[model samples]
Target chain A: MSAVASMRDSILRADTRLSKYHPLSRILFYDDFDEGVNGWCELVGNHAGNLDDIREIARDFRPPQLSSCTFFDIGTHGSIEGTYSLKLATRAVPNHAAIAIKRLTYMRRGLVQFETYFTFKAEQTFDRAALSGWDGNKAPSERQFGDFSFSNDICDGENGKRYMGLVRYLNTDVDGNLVQKWMHKTSVQPTTRMERQGVVPPNQDFHTVNPDDWEEIPGGNQPLCFNETASKVNWHYLKWIMDTSRRRMVELQCNDNVMDLSSIEVPVYDGHYHGLPNLLNFLLDVRTRTNVRNFLYLDSVLVSVDW
Target chain B: MLRRSFTAVLEKNSTFTSDFATEPYEAGWALEARWFVRILEISPGAGLTMTAQISPDGLFWCDEESGPFCLNEVGLASMPLRNFGQWLRLDARLSGKNPHVKVLIYLAVKG
Candidate 1:
């Protein structure tokens, strides 16, 4: 069997060796889609097709309050011979301000059918809101080009002032369909609408921007100190952490514990190397398929991030 | 302050020596003088000095002799500092029955 199939079977069976590496705070679709999973996903506008098919299988099960959560996946692409569609629902505390979290991972096996280079076909999406029912206007965060700056604009609740933010989400639906949805600011916060899922604020990302350090600027409708580049990247990265689970989350030894587990996966794909160079790829393909075919490894993980 | 390509390096090793160094200030790279040059590894009793030798292109020199030091007012030799920093070179010698046989030199420039 391919590595992908080997990995997926081990995970689905909750094999102790692999399961021990991921101590899930809760399992939303352990056996079948449970009412609790449906209830919480629905709170964020997720429906039958929105949660994984397994969630439909676990329509009545539930778990407990979370201190922390870890996840893993060993699967393949939709067409890859080793692809196994695995879905999990659990609490995720992403940062200091997180109230709750839900994470999902769709992984494809690394194939050396022709060469050893791991090929991954994966996609994930989710949403969030910083605050609620505020008069603050939003611009939908347009695509930032060069030298972007954020003006003084409050996006979260502070001093009882209301500000609602929305995170539009798009993900593969339960029936293998893809869906788009949106959630109110607090939808991803401390408690899910049904209070079944969320990071619980105990294991969350930063709750509030430091007023003194990130004061509002004189610019129109922006934060005191905001970089479109840094902000957007960080937001998406955090979003990725919030919605995706990896194959090995225990690798991170952070004392605080709020970390991105998907980061630990044995790469099936990546986009680094100071921006991938396409010119040498043809040569790489030839070499990778020849003497290097079965020997192809991820070579390295792009874990070092710049903020 | 608006600083460009700003960098900071406290000191790889604090062994003061005689060398003219320049770097950008991190605090006030915009308008305020934040890019400060410092001399490290100075003796307590050994007096510190930075003679500002100026040249049209900073090659041929003339001494303007004024620089800061991380030494006490009573003179560096009077009370040696294990590590030191200032916007000027620290001209001092390390001696006395102590074990400091190896010293490293470093420089940090605004790139």
Candidate 2:
């Protein structure tokens, strides 16, 4: 309790918005997918294989490990009561498992916040393999998957540029200390390359900004790894705030802790000829299988506009 | 914003094209809106071409892009409709060898 209090005290009053604004829209259609994946569409060509992997878990299926976290409470209180959470996994083939809400039109540049609860199953453990190719048994060295953003024009086909909404990528360094990066696409354009058309090469039509170019989200030096560890099994609550009108990430909060990322610019669509994400869509991508048996549970998701 | 979603199925070896329009709005409003497209499900190794064309009068239509965007996976794709037109429809052609697949597309505009 004292630790949570200290974390709260550290976040300046100006950076906090949990209590001020009420949720205007859930944003995530079929929020819990209780409607049986009706409003969601898959992007992976292996749709049959991917669809089967996206399942739903009943509410009260697991205790709320994140009850003590303020951000967690904000999302739960704002979401549809007693709704089922999503269980997305990268099972069977190694391809990423993902689903996006069908409604795409939404204001990208606005005062908005996205909150959700995600955690690894108790049986799962970390397995660091190479970055390029998947090792049959383990995930790539860079565990940079989940919560993708092709929904916006950041993936404009013409320039092969990507303007992502939110990307959570985590990995461990040589010293075994957990290293994580949170990224969002700003209006800044990357140097263009050849556009060969459909499913072109990596950087061809979809320019992935260099890791160094991405704004860094500050995480305390403590090791925050999600695996078999009992304490870490608790749900990790995440919150993202953006002022699309200003085109920048206003702030980001993990659990009760808030960090000011006001310097990070939000992606602009002024010169993006291919188009931009006019819709507020979300997706899940588990690019690698954590273990022979493992699952990722999403307790809840809430999106609101305050301003 | 006014947002609506539509679903259609492309049977095996068949082509499907359906028309959907933006929520009818007053003049100069639709021009400020944008449209997003997502192909929900396509059978394995299925080659489906998904295209969005615009019509000012709903009689004559033109391709939104140079060629139809091919779908082989599950993900989100979008296009800005600064002044594209009033009516838009999806044109999908399925690769006969693959099984039938369902398509889910969403349209959103500023309220």
Candidate 3:
């Protein structure tokens, strides 16, 4: 383990504290059918207005990929500011079969105002040393950042020799019981494939021939964590198998955004207008905030696709 | 297409009246801007009227220049004349304390 000693010789105390900040609110998933001008779009809950956390009942979780997932808890008859958005990059993924699969769950807020669906897929040769276990090798900051921002390094090294991703905005609605579901498909399974993946070491000596069996890599606080970040680090590899299965999963989310409009505190009112005289009091084409919204369930299985 | 119901004040602006001349002023520029009109609350009595005026050199006005185009209906309306310059001024002109009007018009070319 001499190679492991050199990297940790000088441990520079590092403080990577994440500051407290606010996340932007997203408005997706809703049925804007009736409620002409002003109305509430709340995805009401069942029973005594109490929300139940039944994960076991939520059979259709999203794809089992190890992508970062966030859950938001919202309220009824009020407003909420979400700190996340669905990050599914549909265009980049490849569905050799007609259908794709993913695991998903409702994190927060139900019966939302609207929702955008996206799909993503990626694959790497088990032999690509430039890649392979890079997810565990790269700084946690970069990996998490790739989930939302444009810092995706999935295919940075190789031009177009990879496939990995998620798609978003599958479905949406305004008011009613909201549910969150994962992507699923029922088709022929792809053949099995394997690879001889390896780990990079700071000190070749400590990483290579330290017959002590499991020799620790020489590094104080390395950004990349080998051994610990496995293919199934948290059911990540399960996603691989899930995608290859003929029967996939379905996921859904619900929010509380649709309003009852009548409940709105209308400060001033001159009764309802009909004819040409009704050309006042409208805030049209202006992006405005709403009362509530939520995510709904995956209505059905994706039986077909064009691309 | 979802639309909101609201109310706005439609006021009458400066009017004009002018006669046509042979020298002919540059009869260029058409009207084209579709400012959305909010219908907060309406009744059967009210009407939307667009006013315009005729100009000689655009400096002079006449009885042939100014008049009103009643929208006839009670909902939203779009008033844009191809030869908007044939008239001098109207209320549809986008200028005032709260210049919130959009008129979309296309004019013909002179041979």
Candidate 4:
């Protein structure tokens, strides 16, 4: 039997190693980027389809097998360390930062967890707001994209709001059919709506806008201030869990830290017309221009479901 | 499962409101609902009070018998809507010192 078939059988029969811990089947899919990066495709703006472009980038940037394991070494443009990380430059052609792929049909009611390991390495100028030069001038204010993201078309909330906001979300229909729906702003904070229109209303006296130092209240969210690019060279483990059982709660774990993004609406978007979350993808985005090439090392992507 | 998303962006001390009109409930589909807050940006020591209200008519609204919640840190502040009526909306009131918290309150209802 094929590898996919064998794995599917093991999961369905509750014969996998994880079966010992949970009564339900686990490990729907696992990828070490060993299959030569053929499983993922590229997406830019709203145009999404095919895997040709992604394969090209992968082949050009693929590094030697890591001793006993195979992994993707992106952004190895003749660096002394060879292919060490995936370099997603804002200046690259197509200017796309996201990739798409499909996974097995895991019940939406079950807890879907996407776990991976990554490290972000960029020039000190990455966070220009800090200190770019001796003059101590702050960097321009622009929307920096997420370090990593996972989006599927299962959510159908708002269409037009996709491009205008930091993230995109398509609406899901009453019968669970996917549709492109436009949501209008009926009730919104006057100031936030104004800020969206390029106007900064006066700050509320009780609110502080900018702060000199940010204190991590002990158990804060993952990718906390300590995980910034300048922190360390150690690999970081990140996990995102979407629990649709009771209240669609999301738990994010960065190493030992945990952030419960409670009562969240649909966070992912699906420009693709597929009605299912077949587009279970892991993406790295760099929205602003970087002075030097940056890197993000990806390894061991996994997804588990209650069934 | 069927799910929908509703968002409310909060400002400092200002109560941001969002009204979500869902589709008529259909038989055979089990229903579930949750609320989450995505911290886009916030001022130091920011806290916000979130309340969900239900109404038969969009105009006349009352607190969701079981829907008042508060969140100090970022992440999901989820609550399941057990027995809900038709028209549902959320209110987020920023509080605390310099309580400038910019967060997106997302309401996910699934059946």
Worst ten in a row by lDDT for model 3 chain A: A280-289
- Model 4 has a DockQ score of 0.01
Give me the overall lDDT of model 1: 0.20
**lDDT digits (tens) for residues A63-174 of candidate 2:** 1111111121122221122333444433322222333333354544476666666554322234443333654434332243322222222233345333445544433322
RMSD of 2: 17.1
Q: Per-residue lDDT tens digits of candidate 1, residues B1-111?
A: 322222222222334334333211111111211223333344444433333222221112333334433332231221112112112122333333331221222222221
Top-TM-score candidate index: 2
Q: Quick one: how many clashes does candidate 1 have?
A: 58
- Candidate 4: tens digits of C-alpha lDDT, residues B1-111: 224222222111122323222211111111455665665556666676767766442334577777577776756566667566444556666766656654544455544
Q: Give the TM-score of candidate 1.
A: 0.18
Instruction: Return the lDDT, model 3, position A256.
Output: 19
Arrange candidates by TM-score, descending: 2, 4, 1, 3
Model 3 per-residue lDDT tens digits across residues A95-198: 11111122122233122111222222111112345355555544221221111100000111212211121211211111211111221111111101100112
Candidate 4's TM-score reads 0.37
Ranking by DockQ: 2, 3, 4, 1
Q: Which portions of model 4 miss their true places by more than 4 Å?
A: A1-24, A45-89, A92-108, A123-146, A150-152, A155-232, A244-247, A267-284, A289-292, B1-111
Minimal lDDT window, size 10, model 2 chain B: B20-29
Local distance difference test scores for all models:
0.20, 0.40, 0.20, 0.37
lDDT of 4 at A152: 33
Off by over 4 Å in 1: A1-307, B1-9, B17-29, B34-41, B50-111
Chain B, candidate 3: TM-score: 0.30
